[model samples]
Target: MRTDSPRLSRPATFVRAFAIACALFFLFPRHAHSQIHPTVSFEVASIRPVAGGESGGEGGTRSQIETTADGLTMRNIDLSEMIEWAYKLQHYQLSGPNSLAGSRYDLRAKSGDHVAESTLRLMLQDLLATRFKLQLHREQKKTSVYELVIAKGGPRLPKDKSATIPPSYPKETFPRVVDGGFVFQNVSLGDFAQQLTEIRTIDLPVIDRTGIPGVYDITLKSAASALLDPSGPSILTLIQEQLGLKLVSAQDLIEVVVVDRFEPPSAN
Candidate 1:
C-alpha cells in the first residue's frame, strides 16, 4: 500500500521528536521571576513641612534611603524631591505650581513587607499619587542632547582588575570633584552616566552609549555648570581631550513631565 514514502523507525521517530522539543525550548525560554515591577505602597506614612524659612533647607535630593523590615525614614526633603526620587526624574522636568519648588517636608513610613530602594521608589510614586493628589502625563518632546561616544583617541579608562563588584570603600563611595576634574572610583559606566545627567551643563539627561562594563575609575576635567567661555572648549570637548569620551549634538525624544494638578501637602 506504501507508494513513495518510507515509514520512520521507532528510534528515528523518537530522535526527531526530541530535536523539535529542544528547539522549541531554546526559542522561547521562560523566566522564573517577572521582569515588570509591581505597584508598591506603604502601610502607614507621615509627611510634615519643615520649619524656619531662613534657618536651612536641604539643597539637593537625599541620595540615601533607610529601609527596614517594617519601617522607612527619609528626611530633609520636599514633596518635589520625593516626586523626583520616585520617578527617577530630573527637577527641571517637573511642571506644576511654583509652590512645589518652595516647599520642603520630612517623610516617615512603614510598609507591609520589606522593600528595596527600587521598590520603595515605586511605593513613593504611589504615595505621591494618593496623598499629594498628583496628576501627570508623559509626552515626548524634542530636546537638544549631548550623546556620549568614544572619542578619536578611544576610552582612556583603566580596565578594572577587581571582580565585577568593586571592593568596599572605607565610607559611602561617591564621585569626587577635585581640582579641575571629577574622579569616580569603582563605579559602573551606567552610574557614571547617571552622574553626568545631574550636571546642569547638560541640558538634557545623559544617555550612556559606551558599552564598557564593570567598575572603573573615570576622571574628566570640566565645570559642572554651563561653560561660559565662548572660546574655550566645552565640557563636551573636555571629555574628549581628557577622558577620551566625546559628546555629539543630537535630537532626543525626552519624557516631558506635564503636571495636571498638585496640591500642598497637609501635615500628617
Candidate 2:
C-alpha cells in the first residue's frame, strides 16, 4: 500500500521561506553591498594657546602658516585667520565673532604620508570641527570689492618665461616686501589680486578681472604709507603707473562663511 506525505501548514511554509532568505544573506560577503567612507583627518595634531596674546606686528596676530607635503604648522594664529586659510577665503568672505581673533594658538598637524595642499585643507577643516566644535554656513551678500583690470595703458606685467603652464601650489616664495613696496615673481594675476587683499591699505576684497593668463613678475614701488598719506599718490595711481593695473571699486554678491558656533578646543 502507498502512503501520502503530510502537507505543510501556512505558518510552517512562511518560516521555511524566511530561513532560506537569512541563509542566502549570510552566505554573501558582509561588505559586498556597502562600503564605508571615512572623513579625511590628520594623523597627528596639536593646538596650544599662546601667552600674552600680543600681535605679530604688521601682519596682525598671525605670525605665519607653513605647510609641506607631509604636514602644516601655524604659529601665533587666531581662529579667524585659520578659518580664512583653511577655507581659502579672504577676510571679507568671513563673517564671525570678533572673539575668534581675540585668542591665539600654535597648531601643528601631520599626515600619514605626503598629500596635496587641498587635502591638507580638508584635514584642517576636520580638525576644527572635532577640536573646536565649530559650526558654520555660507550665504551670499552684496559687498564692496575692488576689481583688478587692465588700465588705459594696458598691463605692464612681464610674463615669467620660466614659469610652468600650471603653476605649483604653495609656492616656495610669495610676494616679498621691500623698503618701499612689494615684489612678485612667477605669480598669476589672480594670485596678485589675492595678495592685494591682505594690504592694510587696500582693506577690501580684490577680484581679478584682468582676464589675463600665465604667470608674471611684478613690482610696485609705492609705499604702503602712500595709501594713507594725503599728500602722496594713492594706490590707484601707483598701480596704474607702475603695474598698468587698476582697481575699480564696485559692489558684488559674494559667498561668505558665517560662523554659527565655536568653542575652545578640547583637551589634547
Candidate 3:
C-alpha cells in the first residue's frame, strides 16, 4: 500500500519556507535591493530660530558651522549658508531670495559616531528638504571666474610640517583671518582657491589650475581693506608677489542653484 509522505511539522515547514526566502534574497541583484532602501538620515535633529543680533560661540559669526564625526552644529546660521554647506557650493553659485540670508536658525543634528562628513552633508540636505520644505534646481549660466595659476617665479608655498606631527600635539588653526591678513595650513591648491573667494577683495569664483600636488602652509599679509583703496596694491599683485600665484579672470558656464520654493521650517 502506498502511503502519503508524513506531513511535515509546523516548525519544519516554517524552516523550509525561511530557507527558500533567504536563497531568493541572496540570488537577487544588488542594485535592485539598493533601490528599495531609503537615503541615510540623522538619528536625531533639533532646529530653532535664534533671535536677531544673538551671537554664537566665541569668534563665531551668523554663518558658523561645526561638524564632527558624531554630528554637526550650526548657530545663528541662515538658510543660504546652510545650503552652501549642504551642496558644497560657493556663495556666488547660489541664487535665492535675499531673505534667505536674513532668517537665522540654530541646528543640532546627531548621527553615527563613525559617519563621514560627506554623509553628514547628505543628511543635512535631507533635513532641509523635509523640515524646511526647500525646493531648488540647478542650471548653467555664464559667469566671471578667476583661475589660480603659478606666477613667473613658480610656487613659493611653504610645506605644511604639521602633517608629520604626532596626533597628541595640539592642532593649529588654519584658514585664519588676522588683522589684515590670512593664514592657511595643510591646504591644497584647490582649497586655497576656494578660501580666496571668501575674501572681499576676491569677488569672483576662484578656480585652481596650479596643477601642484600636496598641501601647504601659506600666508597672505596684504590688508583686506586695501581692496577699497585705489592707492594700495591690488590682491592680484599681492598673490603674485607673496605666494607666486596669479589670478586670471575668465568667463565660463557655471552650475548655479536657483530656489524654486522654500517655506519657513516646520516646528521641531
Candidate 4:
C-alpha cells in the first residue's frame, strides 16, 4: 500500500515562494547611486578700486558732428551656448544613504530617459565654489521704529509708517544671523575699520542693491560705511575661475534634479 502524506506536496509551496520572490525583485530593482562631494569654498583676497577716465567734453556746444553719414554698430559675445551647457551640468545628487564610498548610479529622466553620470552634482558645486570664491554669511535683527501717535494732544502719525526710518539698530536687537557676505558682523568696529584698509575698491555699475542694501542707502550705524562696486571681481567671477562654470542663458530651462548613483557622506 502506497502512503499518501502532506509532505509529498511541500515542494510545490517552496517553488511558489521562490517564484514570487523573483517576480518582486524584477518589479522593483534598487537603483545603486553615489553622493556628490562638496568642495572647499574660496574667498577674494584683495580688491583694487578702478577709476573711470573722464570722457573729453567741455561746454554743451563743444561736441559737434556731421550726421550726413548714417551707420549702425552692434557688439556681441556668443557665451549663450556655453552658459546652456553649464546649467545642464548643475544636477543635484538626489539619492539616499548607500554603504559604499562610491555609489553606483543609473541617471535617468522622469520618463526614464537617461541623463548624464551621477557624479555631475559634486563636480558642479566644487566647480562653482573654487571658481567663484563664493563667501556666505548669515545675520538677523529685530527692527524697532517709533510710531508717531496722537497721544492726548501729542503729534499726528505719518502717512507712510513703513517708510519711516528707524534710529540706531541695536546689536542686541539684531541678533539673528541671516545669510549674507558682511565681514564685520562678528568683529568689532575698530577691527572692521582696520580690515577695510586691506581691501581694494573697483566701482562697477549697479544692477540691483538687494544683497547689499546698506551700500546703496545709509543705515543706523555710522560704522556700516563699507561700499561695494558690482562691476569688478565678485562671486560670479569666483565660480567661473574655480569651477569653470557659468550661468545658464536666459532662455535655458532649469530643473531640480536627483540621481541614483550618489549618496550623502553620513551614509559612510
TM-score of each: 0.62, 0.73, 0.76, 0.18
Question: Among these predicted structures, which one has the highest lDDT?
Answer: 2
Cα deviation of 143, candidate 2, in Å: 2.3
Worst 10 residues of 2 by lDDT: 165-174
TM-score of 1: 0.62
Error of 4 at 74 (Å): 31
Please provide, for model 1 over 1-268, each residue's C-alpha lDDT reduced to its tens digit, 9 standing for 90 to 100: 8688889999999999999999988886655234554556888898766564321224443333345566566555666657766787755556667667577665788888766667777788888888888998887778776677788868887777457542322111235776756776656666676667666566666666788776777777655332556566777777777778777778887776777887776456
Model 1 weakest lDDT span, ten residues long: 165-174
Which stretch of 10 consecutive residues in model 4 shows the poorest summed lDDT? 66-75
Better of 2 and 3 by TM-score: 3
Ten contiguous residues minimizing lDDT sum, candidate 3: 165-174
| Model 3 lDDT at residue 161 | 60
User: What value does the lDDT take at residue 129 in candidate 4?
Assistant: 33
Looking at model 2, residue 249 earns an lDDT score of 94
Candidate 4, after superposition: displacement of residue 164 in Å? 44
Instruction: State in Å the error of residue 219, model 1.
Output: 4.7
Q: Clashes in each model (backbone N, CA, C under 3 Å)? A: 0, 0, 0, 32
lDDT of 3: 0.78
- Name the lDDT value of residue 168 in candidate 1: 26
Ranking by TM-score: 3, 2, 1, 4
